[model samples]
Target chain A: MDHLVILPILLPMFAGALLLLSGRASEGFKRSLCLLATLLQLPLAIALMAQASGGLQVYAAGNWMPPFGIVLVVDHLAALLLLVTAVLAIAAVVYAVRGDDLLGANFHALFQFQLMGINGAFLTGDLFNLFVFFEILLIASYALLLHGTGSARIRSGLHYVLLNLFGSALFLIAIGTLYGVTGTLNLADLSQRVAQLPAPDAPLVGAAAMLLLVVFGLKAAVFPLYFWLPKAYAAATPPVAALFAIMTKVGIYSILRIYTQVFGDTAGPLADLANGWLWPAALLTLVLGTIGALAASTLNGLISYLLVVSVGTLLAGLALDSHDALVGSLYYLIHSTWVCGALFLFAGIISRCRGPRFVGRLVPGPALSRPTLLSGLFFLAAISVIGLPPLSGFVGKLLLLRAAETGVAAGWLYSLLLGSGLVSIIAFSRAGSTLFWRTDPAAAAGGPVDNVRLAAVLALLLCSPLLVVFAGPLLDYLTITVDQLLDPQEYARQVLSMQISTSGGGH
Target chain B: MELLYALTLGVLTMSGVYLLLRARTFPVVVGLTLISYAVNLFLFAMGRLHTGKPAVLGQVAEHADPLPQALVLTAIVIGFAMTAFALVLALRAQGELENDHVDGRGKR
Candidate 1:
């Protein structure tokens, strides 16, 4: 029970390593092992979530202790994200088994390695370790992005690679600057130290904080920094793109974690560090992303653009910084990830059914083999994404609108949110009518639908309504998570007051 | 001494940004490497500019902090791996597309 916190990180690490060493194994064997590892994470995440709600749970590496050795802190927020990631991993693995897993050597291995990095990033209590985990996941993603051989993919992959490499360079610079000023890499220690930064050193600390924001912003694909996302995501195969959906949220998670804990409203000299620019940029991001969606000629392009819209909305909530706004953001965050991932998978199905020449274009095509099922799934996902009533998205937007009503930017937020929803409505309606109504029934009838892939998409699509159904409990959990996030004094105390074995300190 | 370090960082960063704006892949890869070098050096300097003292405790009033060195070592290794991966990707793009331009064509 006490060791549950490390299992999320360690299980994937060991699984990934084992998969790497067993290169001669059959594909089926490797995949099942990956599935088992991912399945184990769901219950483990639940247990960690339960335990974390009691208090912060810290596991010091090598038993050396807090400020000196590495620590993994399982608070409610980390646990919630872990659970969400684990669910997505399961769906992606199941979908890949329908044949996308054969794209490259050891795809399962890299997937697990990616999970290891993501879970480590969420769980680690140290800043430098977060950088290491970012690189781990990123290198894995670079390889995954180019999983198949195509000129278009390699072209976009190059841009993605170079851009992220640049982001990483800035990340290192930020961490170095922060360490130089604070002399500690442990997050809990840094939180206390950052609040007490002397006047002479305050500017340096503020610079470090802002640079970190830029690095994370690049990851999250904020307004000016998001140019590399749409094309890169569109070029990847469907299952891989679905898995990549959660990757952006990692950036959002970090922003929420750092700002609320280390750079909160009470930050001594650097209070409201990035707020001046954040909401305005987020609003612009929302506008640009929706416009991009409307302008997108292909269905994948539209979905990717919608992803940008979701991030913009989430950031606006983050900018508000009110408890209600955060609650809405967390709820919206989960809903968007699930729905976005499902849309990517559905795009694959749509493209496969329509043939490669007319891949998910908003043009007339032959009717699908299972037109009803395909169209039904598409309608559900589209409705949810466009924030129509009775779906999780509507509930999420309602909460966010209510939260925004109390903010200074209420007028702007209301116009953009509603306006974006209207634009998506027109876009999705046009695409849907062209896709289902205009296609000739004879030409599109014979494409064989893979049941495994169908089941995987169905599972994630089902989660949208399930989210709405269980909104009451989920909001309860998110409220506690936000409360835990805002109240960092207790986190600092818990992390700092751990029993340390002073004699075994060998670094 | 600080001026020298800051100037070196600035020059490397400027050259990196310049190359990164190029339309070719190899130069961009080189630019990434140069930027990482600058970042690594900056991380090393975070421990402060210590000259002759051992990294461990010594008779001197202060020793070089070993943590940044460790951090920089990790960064170097990861950066090397990324560079190798990016180079392989560039070579493949060249082989398949018959071009080395970052976008594989004249325009994005």
Candidate 2:
């Protein structure tokens, strides 16, 4: 059993703890240390992804058997997400190091702790442990969201904190109910138990499943629960908002992971329980998110709504619940996380160039110092986000559109998916023109752009075309990932049958 | 006994929710704390309430389900920390924004 599985979680835990204690250290030292840890994570994630491509790998924490102790399970999905997170971390940390860290105390430490929580959430196999990791990540996020203090951040922080605390309470009730009914909290064990659940217990389990969906939906920014996201993400600093691109995906992952594993097709009466509810929510989320994008007055607000739109797209693909649709959803998930993250950094850059008076407000402002370079980057990002042909977003949407089944469902999927694409084109172009083309000629030219921050933006922005480059191999890997996901019994067999052969070492 | 326990949990949650929905920050924080208490109790009750049962196994025939107890402990710690954060955030918002309204707008 390779202990490499735990390194993703442990590396950041230790680094974050040390950084937190050494808050008195110089910024340069903290930057190097933070950069070193984030840089180390990329190769580690790739190695893990390679290892995961072979099959499902489970690491029993503390050498305890699966049903009794906490376990970290890495499959194609987990490994792929870990790599995405690592790449995004490099971008976010690089951006934060360029003066954003100085704007707040303990930024580096909070960042690492955030990564630890995210990585743990991605890898955990136990339901209770998932809640623990959720709190860990949420706690880190509350502080990070309030970084670079402003009245806007503080006010948004209050709502974000209060709402998530309520959500946390609900999450515990769901976990407690599931444990009460099934007598187990291990996801694999719960799946097995759910399959044999008595008729009476099924309703209780169903209720619990709904509560879990509500909590995850709030986190994922589903239609009704997504109200807090736009304000909060827009108010957040660039790097923090960039890292949060993966945060909503964390909710999407939980929805897919838990729903598929615990109450999937094999769970008999309770199988696919949440799909009925998720279907409408996914569609409404799409419509509302697109409208929000169109109405957004600020550049960051536009990007934030676009993030909600991505969530809607991904959730729709999941709600469609077919193999190909899932493939598209997963593909789109990666594209949106990276490109959307880069867009947040773009907001930051644009705000800087626009000067203090106009911060990417979709209005005529001072002419940019580097209009060609900045506009060129904006055009590339806008095109990619709008899902134009030959980019990663285009491919993901194509797969999704192709996957929609015939009849009312396909009609809705095609119209809405394509309609949103067209509307986004308009929204992005309007914002783009106002930002770059409609600048006031008389005003002073904006200051020279920061190269360090630009490099950070390039790191994530470049992945759009890079994903297109790797589309073939990536799709093939995702094909296996989706199929592996559809089969829950194989997962249960592997996890539940781990015998305690060596007492300490995993069997 | 079960009815009373259930009512107590319900009241805490209800009160917590009522306060949580208030416009002011202080009441909202208090409401969140109340909900946390309800959640803790509910989690503890999920293991099936028992009297005079030992938490440890092998000490007595009627050892309680230790898992919920353990889960409750974790939930309590998390809930406590979150409440403190919420209270401090409320205070800071009050100080920074010059009002305690959750939305930061003063009375119209």
Residue A498, model 1: lDDT of 91
| Docking class for candidate 1 | high
Write the residue-wise lDDT of candidate 1 on A268-309 in tens digits.
887768877789988999999999999888888889999999
Scoring only the second chain, what is candidate 1's TM-score? 0.92
Candidate 2, residues A51-164, lDDT tens digits: the string is 997878898888889898888999989999999999998999999998888888899999999999999999999999999999999999999999998999998888899889
Each model's iRMS: 0.7, 0.6
- What's the lDDT for all of these models? 0.89, 0.92
Backbone clashes for every candidate come to 0, 0
What is the alpha-carbon lDDT of model 2 when measured against the actual structure?
A: 0.92
Q: What is the TM-score of each candidate against the true structure?
A: 0.97, 0.98
Docking class of 2: high
Q: Which residue pairs overlap in candidate 1's backbone?
A: none
